[model samples]
Structure formats: structure tokens, C-alpha cells
Target: MGGPNLEVFKFGFYIMFPIGIMYYFGTNLDSKFSVDGFWPSKEQSNKIPTEPEDIRAELERLRRRRLERRATRLAEETRSQQDMAGDGA
Candidate 1:
């Protein structure tokens, strides 16, 4: 059976041990774990627009590009199907 002193020591050990370990190991963790080019550089980040209007315009441009690609793919599929039908006749 543990005494009050033992219980207090156990509590302090449980609390202090992990904090000490983190403090020792966490200091250089970012530099150690980070990969080169994984994060945007300052110039690349600066090119990204922070304004709501610019963000919306960028999104709209991407959406239009995606729709254009989809339309071109669908048209190609339709033309291929028509050519197959013409060949079968």
C-alpha cells in the first residue's frame, strides 16, 4: 500500500515526465521533419491572393477550365461513338 508521499511523487512523476520529454525533443523537430519544397516559398506565397474578390476570381477561372476540359472529353467520346456506328453500317 502506497503512502501519501508515494502518491504525491507518482502524480508529480506522471505530470513532469512527458512535459520534460516534449521539451527536450520538440525544439528541433520542425527542421528535422520538414521536407524541402513541401511548403510554399515567400514569393510563391506572395503570389497567392488574400483578397476575397481575387480568391473568387481564381476559383471561377479554375471552374471554367475544368468545365472546358469536361466538354472537350464529352465531345471526343461522342465523335468516337459516331465513327464506330458509321463503321458498323
Candidate 2:
């Protein structure tokens, strides 16, 4: 079951089949299937720090923000507990 024509056809099929499939499935995939507004817009996205000093500054800012949030949450919890205690008394 070996012939020159058949071997050439087999080689062509092997090469072309995957390329055809890739072209069909890969074209316009992001636009067609992607959900609109799922990704953050350029203005909303945070820029990554490129310099060492910038990175350190960003880390410090984030740390301070986190601590502030934690402090505020703890204060709210404490106030809620105090209110509950006063209501029971």
C-alpha cells in the first residue's frame, strides 16, 4: 500500500490540517468569545513599578493602606461590642 502520490498527499494533509484548524479557531478569538469589560481598562489598572525605589515606595504605600483598613475595622468591631454590652446592661 505504498505509492509516491499517496505519500505526497499524506505529507500535505499532515501539514495543512493543523494549520487550517489553527486558522479557523484562532482568528478573532479574543473579540468573539471574550466578555466585554471583564478586564480592567488602562486607566483602572495599576502600573507595575520598574525601579527599585519605586517598588519599595509602592510596597510601603500598600502596607500603610492595609494597616489603616485593619485599624478602622478593629475600631468598628470594638464599638459594636460596646454597644451590645450597653444594651444588655
Candidate 3:
């Protein structure tokens, strides 16, 4: 006795979704809808490549560079400590 009208709820989705879609597409008539700075054209979709592999490669390269710099800094720190220890002896 305290619920929504069944007749009004019936076919609500069939009408609501289509109307919502129409309004959405209507509002975005002349602009590009993009996600994550990557918007692919229908024809260009075949050529741009997937995000996962590219992200993996880019992350690997960045990790390698970061590790290399860390190693270099560590080596320099070790060399300075050794020189200090030798001078003290």
C-alpha cells in the first residue's frame, strides 16, 4: 500500500533510457566526448593501439630510469663513505 504505482513503473526503462540518451546526444552535438585524454576516431581506432601495452612499456621505462638513478646515487654515497673511512684510518 506504500509503494510506487505499478502502471507508471511499467515500461519506464523503455521510455526513460531512450529519452535520456536522446537528451544526452542532443546536448553533446558538436563536440568530442573523451576519456583519459585518449579519444580515437572511428577510422583511427584500428591504428592507435591499446592502452595496456603502452602503459606497461612506459611504466617499465620509467621504473628502469628511476632505479638507475637510485643506483647511481647509492654508489656515490658509498664511495664518499669509503673515502671518509680511509682518510680516518
List lDDT for all candidates, in order.
Answer: 0.93, 0.97, 0.81
Stretches of model 2 off by over 4 angstroms after superposition: 1-38
Give the lowest summed-lDDT range of ten residues in model 1. Answer: 40-49
Candidate 2 per-residue lDDT, tens place, 1-89, comes to: 88999999999999999999999889999877899899999999989999999999999999999999999999999999999999999
As a TM-score, model 3 comes out at 0.43
Which of the numbered candidates is closest to the native, going by highest lDDT? Answer: 2
Tens digit per residue, CA lDDT, model 3, 33-83? 645547767777754436999878877988999999999999999999999
Clashing pairs in 2: none
Give lDDT: candidate 1, residue 10.
Answer: 99
Kindly report which residue stretches of model 3 are placed more than 4 angstroms away from their true locations once superposed: 1-50
Query: Deviation in angstroms for 63 in model 3?
Result: 0.5
Displacement of residue 29 (Cα, Å) in model 2 is 6.5
Q: Whole-model lDDT, candidate 3? A: 0.81
lDDT of 1 by residue, 33-85 (tens): 78879889887775777999999999999999999999999999999999999
Better model by TM-score, 1 or 2? Answer: 2
Model 1 global lDDT (CA atoms, 0 to 1): 0.93
* Model 2 worst lDDT run, 10 consecutive residues: 30-39
